[model samples]
Target chain A: MATLELRRLRKRYAGGAEVLHDIELNIDHGEMIVVVGPSGCGKSTLLRMVAGLETISSGEIVINGECVNAQEPAERDIAMVFQNYALYPHMSVFDNLAYSLKNRRTPKDEISRRVNETAQLLDIAALLDRKPRQLSGGQRQRVAMGRAVIRQPQVFLFDEPLSNLDASLRVQMRQDIRALQKRLDITSLYVTHDQTEAMTMADRLVVMNAGRIEQIGTPMTLFRKPATRFVAGFIGSPAMNFLSGNAGDLPGWLPRVPEETTEPLTGDISIGIRPEHIALTTPNAGQIDGHIELVEPLGSESLVHVRPTGHESRLVVRHVGTEQPDAGQRTGLNLQGPFHLFDHHGQRLATRPRLADTTCSMEP
Target chain B: MRYHRPGLDVAAHTLLIIGALAFMLPVILAVLASTQSPGTLFSGTLPLSFGTSGLDHYMTLLTEPVRGVGVPAWRLMLNSLLMALGIAVGKLTIAMLAAYALVFFRFPFRRCCFWLIFMTLMLPIEVRIVPTYGVVAELGLLDSYPGLVLPLLASATATFLFRQFFLTLPPELMEAARIDGAGPWRFFIDILLPLSRTNIAALFVIMFIYGWNQYLWPLVTITSADHATLVTSLKRLTIATDGTPPWHLATAMTVLALLPPVVVIILMQRWFIKGLVDTEK
Candidate 1:
């Protein structure tokens, strides 16, 4: 296992504009880092650069303290699981898992032993003779994983490997992958656009936007204290609601907004509040009043969409149980314990107390 | 409720039957002509008369002088096989390598090279025949297997078809193979080529038929009748007029010439359609 460091990595297609900018990330040994972003955000490009599928335009990718920028993917000693589960359609599952070993000229008996062991680990021993086309989506996914696992390379790279599976299968495979990674403790870099997958499965979540790193921290740290408005909005399901309210409108129960120095908040500043943090209360007890636009109930919880009076912004609140107010009914919103405050430039202000606050403190 | 369409179905089936009959007509005529004696073939008397019983035609083709040239039909058949197989193997190897490069590499001037190669498709061999002949003659490849095969080796049609095929293949397959420690050649042999069996089979059938039926190039290049392919030999045999055209033996020879390609098409019919259809998808 090796720590993979990408130092100011940049990628630009021939005669085309740059797709990725100066990306600097250090993946420590035995760490599982998930690069999460939206489509066309260059997450896949970054992963491909590390895998040697893409050429490094202007920077170095050092793996195990050696610069692999000039090396072929084969010489890099990495294994990758592709999103589409790129199993050889013509080969049986056994052959698919054994292909890499055979290519490396491994001994026949050892190849068989390793393949069989991986097949068993993936619970696909009975499917050894089946081709990829014959397998279901989930089975093909396991076969793709098995193909990578049998190699036991220095690093594992997954490019949205579970995105092809059904929801239940994706959840199951997510747990299986986490368990496998923890057990093997291989340095792995997983790329996905799914924020939940990144949040649940990563040792560190590298949130990206527009070919730039928005934030890199533990999942909870990112959720609680995102370093930018982009991270606050992108890292959660239903997304964090951004309110364009001034400091004068700050609720008395919540912490005071950070004072502006040198650069005053003359323009618009964004206040980020996650759905679950916002509470629905009686009109007199709440800070802001709005009419309920919609309520999406999920058995134990409900998402209440509220449009505050005289404001263009609609806020979503996650309330527990089926206790939901009727649509078009005037309701009040109570800002909860933690909220993210961002300047007009989208930089988070250092008002909250958290580990991610260190960087914010130095910014001012 | 949807209205039932009666006349449309009847018209569709009628048109389809007519199209099927039109396509089957040649094979039916060939089968019937092969069975008839030479004297009765073009007699145009009865449409379906069982002609004079004959292993004579088959035996005659085995022994008869083809045209005034005295080239045995069996030798011509063997020549056709050698030329076709040579062309098929050569075209497949070159096309696969070229296609693989175009699909998965980033060398300098790559797109420009691809466009230049692809541009050759617009200029058919007919357009370049005279110049091609001059080049072949200048290189002294005339009347040899290299003369017959080399000009056809760099097939833009096969390269184009294989490129389209390889482009549809998930890029991840190549990436996965590379990360598994397989170099470009290893990836091609172990991953890309194996997954491309249907495409290779389809291209093989198409190239074999093309080589088997090639007349213009071989006709101009091959000076020796012994080295001549079946199509050229057939042209000579049919146009000879030394004696009564041995129509029965000639038909049998034609049948022999058609057999290999026909068998290939039949055997690989599934993969041929699969390759074409999957590529469209």
Candidate 2:
């Protein structure tokens, strides 16, 4: 395993349009850094650039202190698991795992031994002689993983490797990949668009938007204190609710924060609070008054969509338990502490740091 | 399934049987004529009865040189086989390489090069036979296998077929191979060639028949009777400038000429259909 670093990495197409803007990251040995973003956010491009499959417009990718900007992908000694598995269609499972070893001129006997070892490790020993098409989607995914791990390269690159499977299979493979990476202790850089997968699998998550790294931190750090509104909105399930007014507009909103860091809330600002953080009280009992517009029950919790008075947007309040307000019933949205305040430019405001930490620690 | 109609089924069977007989009758007539003696063949109005000179006629044709054409039937068949195999293998090689370069690599004027190759589909050997023969003669490749096969090797049809096949392959396969430490040549040989086996077999069947049936190009280029192909020799045997044409030998040679292509088609029939229709990748 090796330390992988991306410093001021940028990518620009021949048409002079930039896709990745100064991406700077450092992945330590045995750390799995998952880059999560929407489509066209350049996360896959970033992974490809590190794999040497794409040209770096500028900056250097240093793996184990060696700059691999000029090296071929083979010379870089990195294995990548593509989203579609990308298994050799005509080659059997054993040959697919053994292809790189054979290309590297490994001895035939050693290749077979290593291939069998990998097959056994993946629990695909019976599938060694079967071609990729003969295998199911989950089987193919295992073969793809086996191909990467058998090489034991300096680093592993995964480009949304679990996105192709069904919902249950994706979750299973997500855990499988995480456990495999942990067991092998290989430094890995994985890219995906699924926020839940990122939250569950990444040692540290790099949340990206519009070709820029919005925030990079542990999954809990990103969930608790997203550095920007985009990260706030992108990192969570059911997403954080963004209100069009200042947090100061709600009565008793500022008093909840500690007095030391609570500045006079002024200027055009947006308030973001997690769906689970907002509490539903009687109409007019809370900070802002609203009528529940819709309620979607999801087993253990419910998503309550409430429209604040004289507002066009709906705030999705994640209410725990099966009890939910009726769609047309008046409900008061209490502005719980640990609120995210964003400036007009969607940048996170610098207030409420102390209250955020205290409330974050207090939550279950 | 569509509704089963007994009357339509009977009509369809009648039409198919007639079509099958229409196709098979000439071949049967040729086989029967090859077995007949010269006197019986000349006396005849469609001699359906089998004659006794079948072995003798075949032996004579196979062992001795024809009257006008100076090469034995086996030698002509051998030349035709060499030409067919050469053209089939050479066309596939050149076309595969051309398609590989076109599809996989990025170069300046790559599309232009592809279009230039595609334009050759408009000019077949028959259309460009004069200049082709000129080039062959100038290169002193006349009366050689290369002369017979070289002019037909730039197969735009084969190249297009391969390019289409290559395009259907996902681009991720190439990236995966590259990450696995396979260079361009290794990837081509180990991955691309094996994947293209069915396509190569299909094209071989087509190009072999095409090369075997080539008449005008070989006839124009080959002056030596020893280098004459079976098709061209058949023409020589029919248009005997000195006397009545050797119909018996011509029929026997025609029968022999049909065997190789038929065998190739039958052997590769499965792959030929799969290559055209199967979306295995």
TM-score of each: 0.88, 0.95
- Candidate 1 residue pairs in backbone clash: none
List model 1 lDDT by residue over B141-188, tens digit each: 999888888787778889888899898888777777777777888888
Report clash pairs, candidate 2. A275-A318
The count of backbone overlaps in candidate 1 is 0
Quote the lDDT for B56 in model 1. 63
> Which candidate leads in DockQ?
2
| Model 2 CA deviation exceeding 4 Å by range | A246-266, A353-364, B1-3, B270-279
* Tens-digit per-residue lDDT, A1-364, candidate 2: 7999999999999999999999999999999999999999999999999999899999999999999999999999999999899899888899999999999999999999999999988999999999898899999999999999998998999999988899999999999899999999999999999999999999999999989999999999999988899999999999998866644564343335323335565666777778887888888677678888899999899999998887788889888987767899998777665678777778877664453334322211
Fnat for every candidate:
0.76, 0.78
Off by over 4 Å in 1: A245-268, A352-364, B1-47, B238-249, B270-281
> What DockQ number belongs to candidate 2?
0.79
Candidate 2 lDDT over B1-281, as tens digits, reads 65599998899899999999999999999988988888777775757877778577778878999767887889989999999999999999999999999999999999999999999999988899889888999999998888888998889999999999999889999999999999999989989998999989989999999999998888898889879898988887899687778788778888999999999999999876776674456
